[model samples]
Target: MGAEQNWIPTEIGPADVGAEATPYGLIDHLQRLEDLTGLLTREKALVFRGFGVTPGELDKVFDLLLPNRLAYVHGNSPRTKVGQNLYTSTEYPQEFTISMHNEMSYAHQWPARLAFYCEVAAETGGATPVVDGVRWLAALDPEVREAFAGGVRYLQNLHDGYGFGKSWQQTFETDSREEVEAFLAGTEATWEWKKDGGLRVAQLRPATTRHPVTGTEVWFNQADQWHPAGLGDETAATLASIMPVEDLPQSVTLADGSPIPAEWVEQIRDRGLDEAVNVDWRPGDVLLIDNVLVGHGRRPFTGSRRVLVAMSD
Candidate 1:
């Protein structure tokens, strides 16, 4: 089969990140440039400032900013699905950090690339971290990485209704139970529920998905979360009941019939934290990250951090 190398570069002049200068010429042109949609896309993110534009322009910019498969996205939209602390509780909404990850690793139809920008930098604690997802996955034992390539992965998203702390069923918008189940049951993936009425599920996917242009197999799943934790018998069973069991014929187990090692969880957390990129904003700042190679997250903040987001293929 032919490898996918279909790359479409944005028409933003010679804006090389490799350039030593700020590329003042590019910036000046970009500011007056009303619509960036033609210049943004599955190609690259054009981060510039001084645009006396409206949200409509921003929308067009987002459309251009996203990968061909996904649209431009911000921290709020993704976090709503994963989990995040709202600004209301924190003292400074601007002073927060974030992690890195693809837009929707849990969902089967994840975007191919991601991009982000910074509109407002906090006085403190708002730096972004990024790591190549493929490199991180390759660092694992060949076998362990191979197992992941098979698409056997899982995730646990807590929804205690902090803002809408209701169960996912209540949180997500859908027509009925069937729609909800269907939504949860990714056509390109599979999953099971946790016993605590939480959704702990897994699906099989390739380990190294080559970036269309980069031709790199990116690590795309959270395996540590998928493996079963042999907690107390009762607890395990309860967790199993609440978790999605359609694909997990047998209970999730470690390499042996042992509880999952704490180190693995720590590893995942450490990787997620270390590799993530964060941005504190001033409402209009649109951010984008290369999803195939990086992860993302938000830290605690104060006040209302209202942000809009979108993703596309």
Candidate 2:
């Protein structure tokens, strides 16, 4: 995490590959690469800049980068689906920074790779910050890491059709209760239906995971994002004033259901952001990352910004 060891995404420009700065030329360059996946595993992240890739031409590029794109099922972020299995990056407010976390790391299964396309760059800020999971883990205090070694328990309270946060239908991207149950049946999660037409789900997941290819263990949980302490003090206080802790939209605790200290979550949130390297966006730039090896977040911004994301297993 030090300056000397800071890792940034490898940038591949048109000139780097000896190609024209156009979609067709970029496609040709990618087609000639023999081991794209292996290259990604070693680099952790690759940023394609100065290619002038347009929305109309994104399909071909995405097909080469993220084959077999996945739907954002069970995703917690608020995003608009704009194309086949493609979504606008989290619709969080532009004035507040989004802390780093691996996408869906709290779930039983998560994507192996993530691709982000910047369609409209913000006038200021709005850089996507990514952190190496290994460095992130190293940056945490030993006590904090030890506390999470027992794993973490995540709870979600999704309303039937209206309430705080997302509803079950929107969360699972389905209207059928039976289908939702069927999906949950395949995972080690437990759920209950509330009298108020809401659903409560509880899941126990490891705090860290190993990269399938490299066998590198890294910090891989969303405890900070889910914990009230991770929300700024003002937000956490406001939510506490309105409802009981258990009634919050989401909560996290130790796997044995023990409360995690507020200071620990604060440290977790701050350290990840501290160790991150930002990827500034430019219109038509695409970034691909090995999801398990890196965690990503968004910085607060001014002016309009539009970034699309897609994932593949």
Candidate 3:
């Protein structure tokens, strides 16, 4: 199915951005958009003018801005940075249309919501893209879909062996091997370690999860299960050595315990990349995206494309 053909009508208030004494004050004024969207239920996108508000004052609003308050918001400023580091991480800021995938899919824990704000529009490309995760979930194969419904069984390598960033241990507040081991011990999963000491083996989570809002189950495994320690680094390497990462025993049906084919799982990725909607950004444009219902990404780019992110509880 395509995007709901019926456009959810939205009323736009005055673009006049009033001065806010506190960051929350800006939210009070911004609340109108929240109310109009039924907490943003009506439409997936919105743009704000800032009513000629000063950039300095806007900074104050940013201080008060909460991830739950807005999924994404773009300011009028021409300069902003989206990711912390793009080059060493393979995470591009403004390159091409990003594949439609949920943020932090590799992490056992994920944010419920995501937001993007456009500070300035690029002269050429640079557009925010999105896909309806629910729509994709509904179209998945019955057998394969059932497997994902079983829940996601995944492991993330705490080490940045792939060169994404510092080791996962460094990124966390506490990265002690003992602490990590303790966290792994708390889960019910099968695991093993890699030949090298770089990664650990783990299987501490379910194979799929039920969406609290829509009650729909989607393929939660994106890229976490294929890592070295995520699926028993040795097991993953062995599987990768012999078979493609997609063909591994990543998902199983809860009802019959049947396995989901790798090809079927890839289809979900194909749908996300093919059916996603692109959001071309402009300066002073504020956009909110439903992380639970939507998946997003952007292609690599040349110039500086800055965007800020905040998570919703």
- Give per-residue lDDT, candidate 2, residue 88: 96
lDDT of 2 at 52: 92
Q: Write the per-residue lDDT of candidate 3 for residues 184-243, one digit (tens) a residue.
A: 464443444445444444343344455675565444545322332233336545766865
Error of 2 at 252 (Å): 0.4
- List the global CA lDDT of all models: 0.43, 0.93, 0.46
lDDT string, candidate 1, 216-284, tens digits: 566665444344332224644675786554334233333222333545534554565653434335434
Stretches of candidate 3 above 4 Å error? 1-28, 31-38, 41-90, 93-97, 105-108, 160-166, 170-175, 178-197, 201-210, 214-220, 223-262, 300-302
Poorest 10 consecutive residues by lDDT, candidate 2: 1-10
Model 2: residues with Cα > 4 Å off, grouped in runs: 1-4
| TM-score for all models, in order of appearance | 0.55, 0.98, 0.62
**Model 3, C-alpha of 266: deviation from truth (Å):** 3.7
In model 2, how large is the Cα lDDT of residue 91? Answer: 99
Considering lDDT, where higher is better, how would the candidates rank from best to worst? 2, 3, 1
Tens digit of per-residue lDDT, candidate 2, span 114-155: 999999999999999999999999989999889899999999
